[model samples]
Target: MQTKMGLKKNEIDELIDKAWKGNLERNNVIALYNVNPIILFQLADSMRKKVVGDYVTYVINRNINFTDICIDDCAFCSFRYNEGYILSIEEILAKADEAVERGATEVCIQGGLLEGMGLEDYKLIVTSIKDRFPSLHIHAFSPMEVYHAARTSEMDFRDVLKELKKAGLGSMPGTAAEILVDSVRSKICPHKISSDKWEEIIKEAHRYGIPTTSTIMYGHIESIEDRIDHILRIKRIQKETGGFTEFVLLPFMSKNNALGRIADKRSGIDDMKMHAISRVLLYNVINNIQASWVKLGLDMAQLSLLFGVNDLGGTLMEEKISKSSGSEVGEYLSPEDMEKLILKAGRIPRRRDTLYFMV
Candidate 1:
């Protein structure tokens, strides 16, 4: 009756039931991995059905990396250069205009931390974009970028977020949150904000009514326990602030990056496990689990539906960060193509805005 890991089968059954109810302990959470893969996936699919039914969602958005010039040298970066390029206001707005022309509902903006790009510079981008296209939702900036700008402007993080929100910032992108474990972050991105600092800034944004998505970058030096810790932290934040819109599982794309040279490579099963376990652990706390199609590749992303993924992220009319890390899936996926992938997976495709509302 005992499995190889020494837990009885009945114990795993109870664990699965507890996971369904969002009550699994830390040890039990790890034990779920040793449970039959089919059973684990089934549990996730069942959870997805109860939470979101058979509908799969995707945002028709674009990624605008306004600058590639960064100061911090993260070991996992393949996108930064000393003084690469910084788009002017006219150039940024022009990209927005092109995005609008191509039927994008939102524009996701993020880039490196330049020396003098302070709060005023950040606000200028938001305000000008809003002024030009009054209807476009601007999902921009990471917590680290906020911290950097705050330091540069000699302003508090809350004050920076308040200014950006006032300037039409729709939401914040939860990047720069690689593993959220201080140990892992120390190795991958030593100069980035600490995990506790990241939490403080995120909670501040949520308290101020600025919603943000949560993310984790795995498949590198981080252990499965590290990922669970990251997930629990997200769940705790949602419990306290009710701010996270969705939880995104971003696998580490290990190519053309320094971290890749020494990081562990994940198998196909690992990708599915990350999605399935995230769904089981998150349960009702964070209902939407997104699988990044660009990083997972189209086929793997589509396969994730059975593993409890309900969102395929965005069309990403243009994506550079992942591309720089050696993603060869190209930069775009049309709305029609998005729907086809969802339909092929036997789920209904629902077009969504940045905030997950039907468009």
Candidate 2:
């Protein structure tokens, strides 16, 4: 078979086999640009099967946006605001209770950086959550939040992380990372922490035995090379600390935001192709790549399964950040719906925890 781009089926298969064997070179992966979508998907699917098998992992988690108040008014964000009422400790605990009652194993608690909030406030929140739901995995905070806490508390980043961990923080959610290139970040999120700072924080987290997921937000004012650089940086870190659990690819949803006003366009097939390439390139540090159903919708997310994504993200109980960004996709998902989506894509689905363990 010859693809639309004239890439032979056997050649794609050979490349996939080499990638699985860890023998594919960077030049070989770059050569895949000549391959068409159909063959590209084929190679991605074959590689997924060879390494991770047919088990597509989904987690039972809920995103609790503790507050929308943010100091960093990123151009691409619809949730950040300098003025907004922050969630009280009682309200946060209420949300945590709701998540537990709804059968969620993980509670991803995050919020914008409030200028006056100290490390004591974060400790109070985490301690209260663990005091109530001791079993619930607390995958809270991003590097940006940590950076903020470090600054507010007038302590080093490591000290803040250590205190938070003692207060029962489990993992980092990997959101502050929009893209690791400072050039793109300077253009889009100048107020946010720099890329090097984010890397240092994540590495420090790993050093302290805290595992975290890595993420990329693409499709707005970033070059393909920037995307590649983002993945490569994560790959290098994972190589050093072996701390990343998985990689999530978030497409830029250009609507109801500043970037959207500049150019209201979402990522297309090319975006999905880059996701596939990430799975192929980060072969050593990353074993599982997740497709965000909330952003891509069910159809495109299922298509991403063929493009080297082995995970369908989570059965998010409440996802306000992405929805607030103008994603029309539903915030809640049932276990049955998750299995059905994976099966429809001709793969097996397994529920997992933050650690990617089959639950």
Candidate 3:
């Protein structure tokens, strides 16, 4: 029962037992931060196997960031442009067409919030895509976008979500939820939605039967306790609404943004630990944990799979947000490349749509 890091058999067994039975206490989860990584990784991988078996999944998707103009000044954002340009409806459709030609099943569309942008415009984007690609899963917009649309149109939030759904928005992206702690958000993204507001929007989306992904941005201006609090909030919502399809762990990329001025570099071990701990913490409540290859390189992403990650995210034909934030890895990753990386990690590779159904 001894691991490579020489941790005790009984201790590892106890933690794993707690995790499997979903009885891991907050104090014990915090204690895992000090556990030997060899033990931590083995236990996490064991839990992953129990729930998802050895099949590692990914999506052949495209990210079409229609614009870079945002009004809010988030400290960690480097993608916002003062002279933001919104793509024409024709231009947006062209990108979707290209994605379909590349064998994509989903197109993830998000952008900076533009002033005077109409709610009708958001609906138009969804309708245009669906009209052309009836079967394509349109995972468009974040909670912030929904909030913005509601404010601009002077309509109720749930009403706005319903209109977008009627216009053909298959799902929503759970961005703008940097951390579910308001104190931390004040320092990172003060102008963005509060934690309670975010939870409200997500729950509303769930009530409308619009499934969305859940996310957390870490490694910048947040404590270990803040991370735990964030996940607990997401877990509570999932227990109630069952709206989240997967949990995505995004490490803060602080190189060219305002937060980078004081942000410290995160070690690879820290990145791996977050993925492993997320799976251990959110075991039964949320099953899928994604390691973002756009942020973590292929090597670290592969290591994450052994630690507790089951999804490698999407085969994004083009990505700009991470690159704008100074991500050195290029944006485009082909399907062959994605499968190769997953195979090297010693797991079965499968392609999934936005809803986690095999495609």
Model 2: lDDT of residue 227: 76
- For every model in order, what is the number of clashing pairs? 0, 0, 0
| lDDT for 187 (candidate 2) | 83
As a whole number from 0 to 100, the lDDT of residue 63 in candidate 1 is 91
| lDDT of candidates 1 onward, in order | 0.92, 0.84, 0.90
- Which has the greatest lDDT? 1
Ranking by lDDT: 1, 3, 2
Better of 1 and 2 by lDDT: 1
Candidate 1 lDDT by residue in tens digits, 1-359: 88767778899889988987778888888889767788789999999999999999999888999999999999989899734999999999889999999999899999999998899999999999999999999999999999999999999999999999999999999888889999999999999999999999999999999999999999999988999899989999999999999999999989888999999988989999899999999999988999998999999999999899999999998899899898889899999999999999999999999888998
Q: Per-candidate TM vs. native?
A: 0.98, 0.93, 0.96
Give RMSD (Å) of candidate 1 vs. truth: 1.1
Question: Candidate 2 — which pairs collide?
Answer: none
User: Considering TM-score, which of the candidate structures 2 and 3 is the better prediction for this target?
Assistant: 3
lDDT of 3 by residue, 91-187 (tens): 9999999999999999999999888776898998999999999999999999999999899888898899999999999999999999999999999
lDDT of 2 by residue, 156-264 (tens): 9899999999899999988889999999999889988899999999999999988999999988888767777788788889989999999999988877689877753
The stretch of ten residues in a row with the least summed lDDT in candidate 3 is 1-10
